[model samples]
Target: MSQGGTSIPDEEWERFLREAEAGSAGAPQEPSARARMVTRRLREQPGPPEGWRTYRPARRRRGKGWYVLGLAAAVALLVVALVPGLLVGWFGGGDGADAPRAAGETQRPDGPPAQEAAGRLPTPDRPFSGSPAAGWADGTAGIHLPAARATGWMSRSEVEQALDRTRDFLAASSLDRAVLRGERPSGAMALIDPHQSDVHEFIEKAFRAPDRENDPLLLFSRFRPSDVRPAGDVVRTRGRISFREGERDAVEVSTDVTYVYPVVRAEAGSEEVVRTVVRREVVLSWNDPAKDRVEPGTFSLVSYKVDATNGGCDNTYTGYFTPVFGAERAATGAGDGAVVDPYDRSTPIGERMREAGDAGGGTATRS
Candidate 1:
């Protein structure tokens, strides 16, 4: 049978020849070896005249030297085009099948990076629970007592010592010349909880800002022992301590502190001292089986917050003072220039607080 422009089957051609021979002889003829040989020779002959041809199979044209050379060149070009990409993928450059990645683009194990997948703060292992006993309030300037009795995790004396140590450390660090010069205070990490990345970032930024002099924390260095009325009253500090139970054998001790300091400034070319009152609420977490253990009386500072600020100082300036401790404001200009808010809420401390309230009372954290 014909297929497209090709010839009929070999079986059909053989049958036709047998039928013609039988009809001519008037009987089935067993063809002689000579006749069969002649028939095979005719089938083998190339390009017979169209009218005379009975059976002819299509032939494949043999390529010339140039044709073979052209084919070889095309194959070489194809291999050259693919080898680089194949090598790149095999050597871990990237998925070579896809477009090459741009510089600085992070290669992910699968899909997009974690931050891009969902624009939200990371969920804490154990989020803060419960609220501060007293909603944000002013802590008086005196020896305020603890609101709740100490639990087994932390004793009354241990809590008292922790508070005292924290207060003293803050005071000492504020006046430390090394810290003013952008050097981290010694033993500073001991007071901070290693697991609290936010607190650590806040501390680093407060001390390590490129412009050391303009750093907000440097404002504390301006205070001299003689600035306050009483020699030892340079720091008018007061705090109230409280405690609550937390997950994983931990105790949350909240210390509401108020620090009133004198910020001496030159206004209208005249010397004037501004009494900046900074109120802050600090939460210290004490865990029995902490990853980083301290001396018997010490506790880790998990978190802290600036509850409120008043006494004519801008909230931005006062806020930083409590949490870490600005902005550049002209010494003589009143309300003419703005103070730069040094506290970067995008930092780790701000990020952590966004996920959970400072006092642990809010159900939803700010992402």
Candidate 2:
């Protein structure tokens, strides 16, 4: 090839080829004077023809500000990745973390929020005076039985006797219309075991009504002992008397009394009486006197609970009577107008009864 657009004559090219052939033929062929002259002439390579200039790559140096910005961006990305995990570990509960928490500081997965949990309130020990189920309307009207004073340690027989006396009094007085009519039975108050504040209050509330003239039949209608028939006698089921060193002696007597009564209901303007068998569970507690010698008449009633009712009788209306006029005689009419359904707790009679003046003995209209 012609070098860089320089032309080579045919004679010179031929001479060069002859020299190259001579060199390859195993002859010691050093360059001859003519070949040297010809090579020197070919070595003069031509440059670019008119105005082309050589190009040089430019060098760029970055400033400190660019390096600083790159470094800051890297640091910011690292912080963004790690900050949430650090926050969770610091303030909120972290995985496998066992940190101490303040008292009452609870965390429930499905319960109320943290503020509500921290500010939760406590429940009352005793919301009302009587049974918890009775709510504010517990018939006792906020009255609680007084604690009974104990006599000395009473024998089981003595406890049974006291309970028997209590049962007999309850059975006899519970049915007497005279007792139901706001008239205390003779000596009935004595049988009440004066220490029983609950019994005393219960008796007091049972026999009186808000208005004697207008609601004359209210007290009687609510409680007519005429319906009660003792199955046999008060039967003692459980008796326990405890005497321990360094402790006050206590007697607990439980008895089951069965009463048969007719639960009367007015149906279709007529009267339907259904006899019910009610099992009353009477539990009594007596404490021994703190002194060495037993005090006479110191035995007192502590607690009494009526158990489940097995039979059905609306005998609640035995006291509720209508006035009947006759030519020669006057008789009490049927209890059709009596609102003595013991199960009818919604009746306004209980409120009215509480409004009645404090009576010595009264029965609950809605047992």
Maximum-lDDT candidate: 1
Best by TM-score: 1
Candidate 1 structure lDDT: 0.30
lDDT of 1 by residue, 75-178 (tens): 01111112222211111121111111112211111221112223321111111001110111111213244433566455665555554555444433433333
Candidate 1 residue spans exceeding 4 A from truth: 1-141, 147-150, 155-157, 173-188, 195-198, 210-233, 266-271, 290-298, 307-367
The true-versus-predicted C-alpha distance at residue 294 of model 1, in Å, is 6.8
Deviation from native of the Cα of residue 13 in model 2, angstroms: 99
lDDT scores for all predictions? 0.30, 0.26
TM-score, structure 1 vs. true = 0.37
TM-score of every candidate: 0.37, 0.30
Error of 2 at 19 (Å): 99
